[model samples]
Target: MPLVLFVDMDYYYAACEELRHPEAVGKPMIVGTGDTAAKMSGVVESCNYEARKLDIRSAMPVAQALRINPDIIYIPADHDYYDRMSGRLMEILKAFGYRMEVISIDEAAVDLDSMSYEQGLVQGKRIKEEIRKTLRLPCTVGIADGKVLAKIVCDSAKPDGLKLVERKDIVQFLSEKSADKIPGVGKKTAEKLEAIGIKTIGDIAKSDLVSLSSAVGSFGFELFQIANGIDESRIVEHYETLSVGRERTLDATKDVQKIYLLLDELSEEVYREITKNGFRFRTVTAKARYSDFTDKIKSKTLGYWTDSPEILKQTAKALIRELIEEKPIRKVGVRVSSLEMGNKQMKLF
Candidate 1:
């Protein structure tokens, strides 16, 4: 049977902070915008395992975390640093040549269909060890026959460890896990499931599909599949998004120049976002919502894929002109679609 392997960096943001100040490796610290004297005024973006020992958690108010440990090391978040490091780490994983899915900034899943269960176990250990040795950052690895089981096992093995759930043990492996153990079951979904007395993975696994579909629509049916270790999702090397866009509802206006200015701003923002996420697109679209709440859209297809703000803005402006006429506009949007994977670099010979 193919093994699905999940890898999650241990307290990723905090770990990155520790790597910068090696003395803090075994010490408690947090990365956020809060200052101790600011009454712990900032939100904790990430906390080291040492801080976690005191029950300090991510998204907790900085002041509350300080109240938990007045001396907790506090540092601001460095997003650029983290993004650069994440890119490098992903490159390393991509080199492994497995079918891969990057689930988060610090988490990924890989399929080892060409290897045996025992081989998967060996490689899982290797990946965990190499990440720590090469990057000096700790991670956890989980190996199982299904993606859902692998992710659950990864959670139980957090902050640096490996866990393997064999194919024969899939049901028993998840029997006691909370319904929220499944990926899509957030707080609200968990509350709904618990209200209906479906409190465990095993409960959902055995629940009636028709009843779940009725209660929660298609999401409920999806949860049923995950609960039963039936997650059929595949591992891709990277995620492919359908669109990148920015839209706004605005004060009614009909001036052509004013509308052009709005299109310029939206185009810049949309293009910036797509560029940051490494996307290029050949289609630019513009939408206008008139005071009457009537909406119209126009699209233009570029001859080639691009991540250029100017190109997008020009195309969107032209398209909007074709759609906007005499109507007092209440909303405008710019969207770039027909995306390509790479963040292409311009070159001149």
Candidate 2:
């Protein structure tokens, strides 16, 4: 049996803030966007567990969070500092010398190869302690037979915890979890499963392939397999960088002119990086995160590869215009992919 370990940092952004300002450790605090003097116009990027108790959440308007707890400390987001911390965290994980996949800035999965479950527990403890001692941060670790299962277990044990679920106990462990608990099963997908009377993982385990497929298309096969304790997801040691992108949170707004202005700035940044690396891309994708934290993405693949900044700006603006019409956006991103090295003399088409 393959043993995988998933590590998730606790309340990552807020926790990073707490590290530098210990006085704020036990207080209700949030990291937000926009100028600190005008924080009410921004949105919460992250909040500590202390703030969560008062119903604060990421993407909530800072004004609303303040109404929930007037005394809550607010700090504007400093992504550069967080990125530095993430770099250091990755360095520590890499030292463990196991095949790993970084899921996000605050989460990663490591393949233990042939380690037994008992050995996996010991290794998990070692990782937890190393991170605590080195960075003064708390993290949770979950060990299981596969990546998805390990991630599920990790989430269940948060804010400094470690858990191990053996193969024999996988089904019982997953039985009561809602269908939406699976990583890729979002609210809409879960509602579809609910319509068919498949409310829990246990229900899916007992369901036939035809019934599951009829509800969620081809994803139902993976859902059924995971519910039955079969996860074939693997950890890759290396992933080729495929995209150049930039994103930022702004004062929540639906103004098309303001959004287009920001998109132009982001496009310039992305174009600089592309030119610096001698790469031309054929695809432009625009991403928008609404105030409710739901994200929508739009992509356009050009017929020809080019490094033209005008094309990048025009394509991104058109895509973003489509999404901004749905809701007020708190964050926006521009990405270019389908890359190839371009000669210095390549035409800017």
Candidate 3:
């Protein structure tokens, strides 16, 4: 039996400032673009719990945040500093010897397969204490039999708290929630469920198999399973992304020559990035968007991986030509995938 724990750092960027400058602890602090003339026009990346009281939130443009409270303290986001702290947190958790998976820059899940549910609860509190003691930062931990269950528990226990949903209590915990609480049930879908009188997780649990599947496809049944506290997904440690790419938008045009020029520009930039990253890729994909926002893609799989800029550019150009075939386009992108490290140029999988 795999017991899982999810630890999520509370208001990470904003908390970092409080940890470094104790004076900022009880005040509203914002992490955003630097103090330039356009500082107020920039984006707010994160804000402390104090700032949130005024409805200031992440992704709210700085201008709006200032309008809420002019006296709010602002600091430029230092991604390097945040990344260092995030790495340190992961290192601390990894020391616990669980099979760990980083959920994001500020969240992670660990498998406690060797321990019983009770043991996991004790270990979860220990982890929370160690992180606070070692980093002077606050976080919340959720413990459960699966990742999704742990995530739901963790989300509910925010602003520094710990929660547990043991195997036996999973269904009861889920039953008290809405259909939207199940992953993949977004606002629109939840409305659809509500329209059909499926308001709660328990409603979803008892939904008609045919109608539910028709409503949301196979995922609907999966949602039903989740409502019943079933999630077979594993705690994977790594995911190898198969591609790296870039895209650009321009005024819509029917001129094939103009499209070719855009493709050449994108190809060169993609090649530059690939070389800079020391990656060799065997697949080239070219994608285009029409004026109507419709998109299409064409790809070429090389028999052998190559780091040569010439080959990459040529393949990208050829794929772009074949894809558009003189059709009008509003945007174009080029990417190389099936990547490998160094000069090996051999597919690892």
TM-scores for every candidate against the unseen true structure: 0.71, 0.72, 0.68
* Predicted structure with the largest TM-score when compared to the true one: 2
Task: Tell me how far the alpha carbon of residue 307 in candidate 2 is from the true structure, in angstroms, after superposition.
Answer: 16
Candidate 1 weakest ten by summed lDDT:
340-349
Q: Best-fitting candidate, measured by lDDT?
A: 2
Which portions of model 2 miss their true places by more than 4 Å? 239-349
Q: Relative to the unseen true structure, what is the Cα RMSD of model 2? A: 7.6
Query: Which of the two, 1 or 3, has more lDDT?
Result: 1
The TM-score obtained by model 1 is 0.71
Would you list the clashing residue pairs of candidate 1?
40-63
lDDT of 2: 0.87
Q: Write the per-residue lDDT of candidate 2 for residues 276-322, one digit (tens) a residue.
A: 65778999999887877667899999998899999999999999988
Better of 1 and 3 by TM-score: 1
Question: How many residue pairs of model 2 clash at the backbone?
Answer: 0
Cα deviation at 185, candidate 3, in Å, is 3.7
Candidate 3 wrong stretches, greater than 4 Å: 33-36, 239-349
Error of 2 at 16 (Å): 0.4
